[model samples]
Target: MSKQTQETGGAPKWSGSFGFIMAAAGSAVGMGNLWRFPMLVGESGGGAFVLVYLICIFLVGIPLIIAEISIGRAGGKDAFGSYKALNSKWGGVGILAVITSFIGLSYYAVLGGWVLRYIFVSVTGLPKSSEEFFVSFTSSTGSQIIYYLVFMIITVAIVVMGIQKGIEKSCKVMMPLLIVCLIVIVIRSCTLPGAGEGIRFFLKPDFSKLTPGVFLSALGQVFFSLSLGTGATITYGAYLGKDQNIPKSAASIAFFDTIVAMIAGFAILPAVFAFGFSPESGPSLMFQTLPAVFDEMTGGKIFGVVFFVLVLFAAISTSIAFLEVVVSFAVNTFKVSRAKASVISAALITCLGIPCALSFGIWSDIKIAGRTFFDLGDYLVSNVSLPIGGILACIFIGWVWKSKNAEKEVTNNGRISFKLVNVWSVLIKFILPIVILIIFITSNPWIMNLFK
Candidate 1:
């Protein structure tokens, strides 16, 4: 890391191990893991999808996370700078991660805006049913764009304050709070009438439903949920202390993040089942079904507020990471102030997000390759950029840079056990790329349509 970067409020390491773990977990446990995971589990046949997803997390997510972080910590630089230190062409890997994160945050903010708006109305008492309320709200152009802007503004404010004061502090506060909120919601939801049926549904696996699609869905979820292949871990790793164990930190982050996702499933599945709704309600399960579930309970408004507040915390934590990747790149690459980079990045994302925010309303009819702007962005990041980025990072680390070099970072320069280093290397070199390539191919619309 350059002294110039340190001089400009960009410390090369986190304040402590705990802070790094919390910040990393906060990055992984975002809106996708919370809201999307359960939906995916439901649609993909609960047990089988989850089983594959957990395996994917350990094999793909953990290894890639360790590799990305180790790369950053080794070079002590931004995502691109980290790779650029190794070789100029390797910077392309970092560039892909940044581009993925940039495009990812644009649509991600739009989703955050949706949650923010839902939070407001959850307290106001909707005269209409939850589904109708969601339909009406999403159909309005001005409301959608306004909420999106509001969410982006909040994101920008946090990033501008720098890492320690902003990112780490926020995560330390938000992660625990988010966990508590989810636990409370889960407790309440499980006690509802016939909630046991939903619990059974979630716990039970239909292995017969396993297909190429399920595997792909689970793999993609692991990638998106763990915040892998997005350069976030790489950028965050740059802020990691030299003495920290990359493997342990990566495992802890993945473990805690998986817990949050599971808790979210418990929070929603039982409530929907108790209310006699289908578990496979897809994306609308959160905005449509859960609101009505809360409304039926005593002190529902309070629960509603807490639920959406939990969601906002998750969203903010993720947005901070996405912005940090870009900000770090700008400060190091362009030699700009953190404030300038933060502002420029935020503004760029806001402008790019306008189409995504509008896709539900004014831009509903607009389509690229038979998908809306929001869906298109999601596909590009989740299916295309992410898988390619992960495979490339693995190839760069396992073969190009040689895993022995990364072994030092994982082992803390021989302080920790170096036993698993060989296994990690082999997986990165032989297993991950082939698996990701399969996922990448299956995730395509044409391929997916065939499976359907």
Candidate 2:
């Protein structure tokens, strides 16, 4: 319990703030940003959705992230341990966050495998019918499971290298490469013959398209894209150095994450528009629509390869963060070594993910509340666990731990200047909980049905 250990939150203090920032940004910048954000934007009214999403990020996402990091840095422990160390009764909230991470990753890895498979498919050249190819590949239970395990193994291997040598090191390389690839694609997408329409759709607000549903979608995207409500942020915070400015670092992470999401939109939407595809394609936008766009574009095979590779990096970066949360819990709680914890955690998560992969084909009819395993996992995590965890975390900080103390942590015991410290306190303590609760209720079919 030396000052150094407290500051670093134990040894291997992220190399420096830059490394921590990169790793944190990597965690926040995932499929949520790269895949979901663009689809939501396209479906939810493009520029209008983007505007509301930015507002949601500021009011809810950043404050909650700052609060979580403050909790982590203050407790200097894993998510559950951090809460227990701060106030033992609130430990359940931490556990909830960890569970969120676990469930999220279980299904997320399946999608990651899809991205990995697409990378090779892009290189090999997309099939004649992108939709049929997508349906066929996703329905192949054995192929899906194999790719899922392969993705998990790659994730576990990186995590087993330990934080600095593993997560941080990989992110440092991958994030930059991912950004570069995004830039390349964006340029190509924008310069296409009819790309202006897509850019206009993405950047020009259409007020008529704004609705309560669009607002909710934007809110959800902000929350998910930033990796809020998951233990991933708290775990990353646990590795932060005392000298690191929490608010500034959190802002930087949010900025990078949002920028990436917007950039991803530019990369995809322009191409979608140029090719005369529907922007309202939902989740299938990435897998089904984009392949056709690539197939038709000049030199698209090259760009397609680059696009999926970018997505693969994003998928890996986030997967490692998710795996790290579970692995860190095991190491801190059970006193297991990092390597052992990683192997066990990864194995369990891989097994858990199997059903999600199979839900596409073999287990397609197997239903929990009429949802296949993949849909069920997504529902429980996105609609249930994440929102509940987020609401409770806000309560823990704003009430139990006191927003003042959180502010202190963010401001480094008041040494660092936090200009909007008061605003942050109010948002975390009051505004956030209500907003997130609304999102929770509105998102859940069961809850919505209760009122109806």
Candidate 3:
């Protein structure tokens, strides 16, 4: 309830935990869940992937999430500042967090541009096919650049408005809208002819297909999907009041994010199956499949427009959160104004985005270890920054900080039984770090295959 001066300090404390939940949900429920989850489920062998993903969410995702949020609340600063504030020795880690987030948002905005382009296309008319549409869109470098600029500008503008007014307020609106739109899409997908088959494909667990690769993929998805790494969660947690219940709020955010992702799978996979298309189409799965379904449905054009609009909302919200992490780091570290920090950060990101944007065109021929600029960025952030950052956060909270101090700070006036704290401690200290490392080691095969 206490108001903080926006210019001199950070935004005011969130109105309550509900606001925090919404903000955290906004960060989590992005293009990853809506646009990417269905494709991953389909490609990774349906139920096998979903089952592994669930395991990863609990074992690795939750503990690390708690650690990140706890660190943020304790430091009361951006990712970099928080680490530096925690210990000067860990300042380099904070810098890595900031840079990782920057790399994430850079290409991430380029993808947002693709989403915006799809939104426009959906309004006008659904594209013919994924490959053709992608080729045509990429061929026109001018339009791609323009769309990328528009997406970046919108993200930067929101960030410039400050957190409470722009980031928090906008998410409160967008997150709910995203949920509603997803629900509607799911309902419509269910009504499709032979939709039941898609449902079975997604929900029916096939234990036989389970493998280490599938488990690792699921874990990586859960970690990346929640926006757990790169210090975004911690930065958001910095705005929380001492009275907030960290465990309960984190659980709520994780549950909501998971539910939306599951619903999205229902919305997408059913339609893909109903249309008699392959779900294992990788990144092109959504682009290739969804448009065909929309083009075939009753009022398909209207539904397509709504779908892409929701996708755009999800992409922009996530991009805004990523940019905020970088902007916050700049402002807190250098003691600069928000406007100056945002502009500087945006300029730097835009420059970094150039290679990512061109990855579809002029830079298409260039490859690092047989991966494009976009792929390299995605790999570095999702595989390295996120998992490692999470590992560091857990170690700091569980081992570096005194247990009594953490319990006092986290619990506030509320009485959390010692048993729960003990459980959390064990998970943070041992289980979570080991799981993340295992996933990181296993995720390399996919990258290795890219080279082979």
Candidate 4:
């Protein structure tokens, strides 16, 4: 928690397309891919939900990414700055996006704390029963606070270094490490006895499970998994060079993001089935089930260490992206140094996150609408704020920014064709907004629980 990085103050640019891709992909591939993606696959009925999710990625995700990034590159500023540059009235939409991301980062750090705790214990060796440990550890208020503080401190340290050296550099390192660790996990998990059943359930399509609610789940997954609706891509895109092809780069990021989610499915579900566990286990599936699976392996202690380390890498990369957006806003909007902005953002996020961290332990009894503080923050961001931000963003770019002006950035001054531009234009204007609105309406737990 005490370790720190020397800060250099400025609005730094990304080195090139490669740096941009790594940072964007690292942001896209997070715990959503590793933890929630697999659980959704099981809950939404295997490949049916995956099919809808992939459709959503192309129809919804790619178009939104291109739009947001175009806003950033054209304006050459933070999310709100970008919107203000386009039209002053739309600036509030950017503020909404930043707020949503900040809310997510608050509870997300606490989850990162959980990931860090697992990494720590996995090195020493998990106990005979990890379920018991998860229960005890989450209920220990002091330990939770310590881990959360350490996790937030590390996030702030990285953000203080600015863009190229800080985010791009860290992502370039962590993304590769995460992929390598996942490869090891995949190889080990696929070899487990009865692993084939899990693979079949993951890859084989079963359309009979399709329902209206499953479509909502798929849409929500695409939204959360790609880090859309958060101004992250817009903030990250503000560093893009004029020559970078926005459409092509956005497409590439989505491809890698979907690939990671599927790879995580291979890594987790196979192990779950092999260990005689139910695949339909919810969010706790990753934390509660994985340890038992790891414990039974030959040299499991070593693999457990690698598994949690891999997760830690994902957590850090994702948190960096979330924190970076707020930092960008502060520096650009307030004319503060990166270090100053990072310090302020970290302090604010840490204070807001205390209730979420305590939710698991001391504040468990404090509830709103039958959800704890962590769950409430998570739902507000993922369910309500994000969707509204996305809807407003789509309206701004599609109607106000207009395809004629916005498409300029995507094509890099006519380097690419205009056919795809019109397609993207139609999507953000009509299809994307409508779909996001559908998710916003149906995301209420009262509604979602009915389908479940």
lDDT to native, each model: 0.84, 0.85, 0.78, 0.84
**Cα TM-score per model:** 0.94, 0.96, 0.92, 0.94
RMSD of each: 3.0, 2.3, 2.9, 4.3
Summarize candidate 1's per-residue lDDT along 1-452 as a digit string, tens digits: 21122322455557677778888888888877766787778667787778888998888888888898999887678889999987677998899889988999999998899889878878987779988888788878888889988998888888888777788888999999999999999998899889888877776788877897788778777877887888899999988877677788889999989999989989988888887876554457778877887788778888888999999999888888888999999999999998999999989988889999888888999999999999999889988898888889889988888888878778877987756788898998899999888878777758768877
Clashing pairs in 3: none
Question: Candidate 1: which stretches are off by over 4 Å?
Answer: 1-10, 42-49, 210-213, 447-452
lDDT, candidate 4, residue 217?
Answer: 83
- Expressed as tens digits, the lDDT of each residue in 1-452 for candidate 3 is 34332423544466667777888877888877876777667667677777777777777676666677877887788887777777667766667788888999888888788878887777777546666887788757787788889999999898898777888888888888888888888899899998988888877767766776666678778888898777778888888876677878788888888888889888888888898876754457657678777877887777787788778778877888888888888887788998999989999999988788888887898999988988899989887787787777767776776555566666763454334776777888888878777766666677567667
Cα error, residue 87 of model 2, in Å, equals: 0.4
User: Clashing pairs in model 4?
Assistant: none
TM-score, candidate number 3: 0.92
Estimate the overall C-alpha local distance difference test score of candidate 2: 0.85
Task: List, residue by residue over 1-452, the lDDT tens digit for candidate 2.
Answer: 11223323254567777778889899888876765777677666777778788888888778888888888888878899899999989888888877888888999999899998998888878765998899999999888988999999999999999878899889999999999999999999999999988888777767788988888878887887787878888888888877788888888888899989889889988899999998754458889889889999999889999999898998899999998889888998999999999999988887788999999898999999989989998888888988898898889999999988888789888788889999999998888899899989888778889888
Per-residue error for 349 in candidate 2, Å, reads 0.8
- Residue 131 CA displacement from its true place in model 2, Å: 1.3
Q: Write the per-residue lDDT of candidate 4 for residues 306-392, one digit (tens) a residue.
A: 988888888898899999889889988898888999999989999999999999888999999989989999889987888888888
